[model samples]
Target: MTAWLPLESNPDVLTKYIHKLGVSKEWEIFDVVGLEPQMLEWVPQPVKSIILLFPISETYEKHRAQEHEKLSVDPGVFPDDLFYMRQLTSNACGTVALIHSLANSKSISLEDGILKSFLENVKDLTPEERGKALENDKSFTEGHHELAKEGQTVADPEEKVNHHFVALINKNGVLYELDGRKEFPIKHGPTTDETFIQDAAKVCKEFMARDPDELRFTVMALSSV
Candidate 1:
């Protein structure tokens, strides 16, 4: 599988990347100072989505396995319009997460460019097929590579990246966790436009609580600039 340099969780770099990929300037990425209520207050209103970067440690892997098993028997309601795709390439989670964040956000206007075109082409494809489409799209891949290099600390493409990213969005009042590496989008219960940041923050807190000693987690929101 092809591997690209991992993207740092820097708002400026991410904002630039999304802008380059066709997301309108009306929306920009901003760091979530903390998961607490006080910190969420600093984030701009009408947050479109939240992206989380966390370590892919044994603890996370184990929990993911357990969660998958439990959800397999009782998968909750999946919105037919939910946009999700699998991550087929190594180190592509950041880009996948960004795509998930933007694609599902109907409120965010997309320009006629790489991301907009890619999403439209894959709108009717299965999740796996969407992943394949992304892998084969030269324009999208080139854009990702170009922006990945702008990170503060770019890692070698061949090096193993221990961290992964996931996007959270409120889709029709339900909060969903969209991780391309996962088999399916995980439902995180109900949420509203006004409470999306707080709801996502709760989930982020849960992730931190699972691995108390790990401190590599980062959170950011896509909101009005």
Candidate 2:
């Protein structure tokens, strides 16, 4: 059996790591808590991306296979500029999703920081290669380690869990789901800058509908201050 690393699913932890990496001062993350319209009313506007936490399951595997088949036949569904990556490590999904949200965001400047340096190093590489590069990135991994320690998540390497994180963002007027586990970015449907939250909420509903009986899922967004 393969060993997987552990990660914190708390949005606060994610926000801490985001700042630690010096992604951008303009960007902020808040827990969605609930997906209802009223709950969303509290979130700041001009949201760049939504991050989801879900438990891995056989049903998710089935959905992934179905989505992969569809994407194989219609690769154009995703925008050409979508930054996607395959999660090379089991526990790295959260990092991958966080990076996906930040790296592809135009509202926030990734100009000169650890993230910018990392992105520059892998800009020309394929998504898979980018994942590998991220796995080996010392600065980024060290930050993740520090945050993990702060979160008290460091544990036996043999421990395993099913939780995972993915990001949803709008690019070229389309809503795309960036899951490192997926072979490519999954384009759900059309969405404009103004309506991305509502559209993304609809997609989140679809995800909820996929496994109606399961309730181990969460949604958070990265928005402007």
Candidate 3:
């Protein structure tokens, strides 16, 4: 996936982290890069997927809301939705792709896929209801598109959509979409792993490197560009 990688515990932190790459452009491109602290701790070792947990605030709706429609602080941020918080998360799919490639990871890659919903995971779905949702992808795509655009759109209406904002990798390895965060229900967040399945998956991938290295980093900037 070509979406900008979310390199932190939450996606909102993108407000500052994009600058580390030395890109002179006005915005950041999402893609995979970097290892988990644990992966890096091992050094020179390649990484498995870096599980990135981005804080998705309940107040996100408030920030983009019209003045009168704005949410009240009394209620505080919207209560965190564990489902939304879980699967649909990440800085950028680009970061995922880069990391997958850099670490030589073999996996189905997509930032949105991490957030996409599947009914088997939804607790309330009647078997029929679940089947219905699975057959519909239009509403799903539109929903994700809007969310992603909310954070990537420029203040100036006429500004061209910034290419740096987001990108995606389809199951078939195609650049399927744009704006990573908008790409899912977040309710359908990434699937949880069983310890044994995770271990077996890792066994098939090469995570060991032969040496050690260090690199310095600096923050640059954030823009809707």
Candidate 4:
């Protein structure tokens, strides 16, 4: 398995990488200063998706294992149109999270390029197959490599990265947590386009609550430019 460099949570680098992958300039990634009501109110309207970068601590791992076990037995409802893929390569969670954020966003228009083509080709494939496809895509890999080096602090590809990214998106009026490392998207609860930012913030707070001593969490939103 290939291990690419981990991506920084910086919005400038993320926005540039997405643009290079053919996301229209009309949308861009912005840092979520705070999860409070006043802070969320300052965020640009119509947030397409929310990405949370959190530490993979023992507490989180225990919860994740328990949740996976529970869901494996009783997997709840998720929209058929919800685009998701697993992470087959190491240190690729950032790219996978961005892909989830873009793929599920109906309002964002993708130009004809790597992402557009990849999504079209994998529309009919299963989640594991989609992961393999992304792993073998040289063009996408190259793009990821180039941008991964543009971050503020470049880390070695083989270095251990304790942080992971997951995207929260609203599909068919339900809030789905998309994590490539997970077996399937976790449906949080009911949400609307108008209340997505606030709803996602609540989930983000839960993540923080799990790791109260950790202050490395970063939250970003994909919204209007």
Best by TM-score: 4
Query: Per-residue alpha-carbon lDDT of model 2 for 1-225, expressed as tens digits?
Result: 223346677767778789877766677778887778888888888899999888778888898888789878887755556778878865778788889998888767765678889888988889889988888888877777677666655644466777788899998888889898888888788899888888888888888888899999889899877
lDDT of 2 at 74: 82
Report the error of model 1 at residue 97, Å: 0.6
RMSD of each: 0.9, 2.0, 19.2, 0.7
Write the residue-wise lDDT of candidate 1 on 108-156 in tens digits.
8888999989988999999999998988999978888888888778568
Candidate 3 Cα deviation (angstroms), residue 164: 12
Compared with the true structure, model 2 gives a TM-score of: 0.92
Clashing pairs in 1: none
Best by lDDT: 4
**1 against 4, candidate with superior lDDT:** 4
lDDT of 2 at 31: 82
Off by over 4 Å in 2: 1-4, 152-156
lDDT of 1 at 10: 88
Q: How do these models rank on lDDT, best leading?
A: 4, 1, 2, 3
| TM-score, one value per model | 0.97, 0.92, 0.21, 0.98
Clashes of each: 0, 0, 36, 0
C-alpha lDDT of all candidate models, in order: 0.91, 0.81, 0.27, 0.94
Give the better candidate number (2 or 4) by lDDT. Answer: 4
Provide the lDDT at 59 for model 1.
88
Kindly report which residue stretches of model 4 are placed more than 4 angstroms away from their true locations once superposed.
none
Worst 10 residues of 4 by lDDT: 147-156
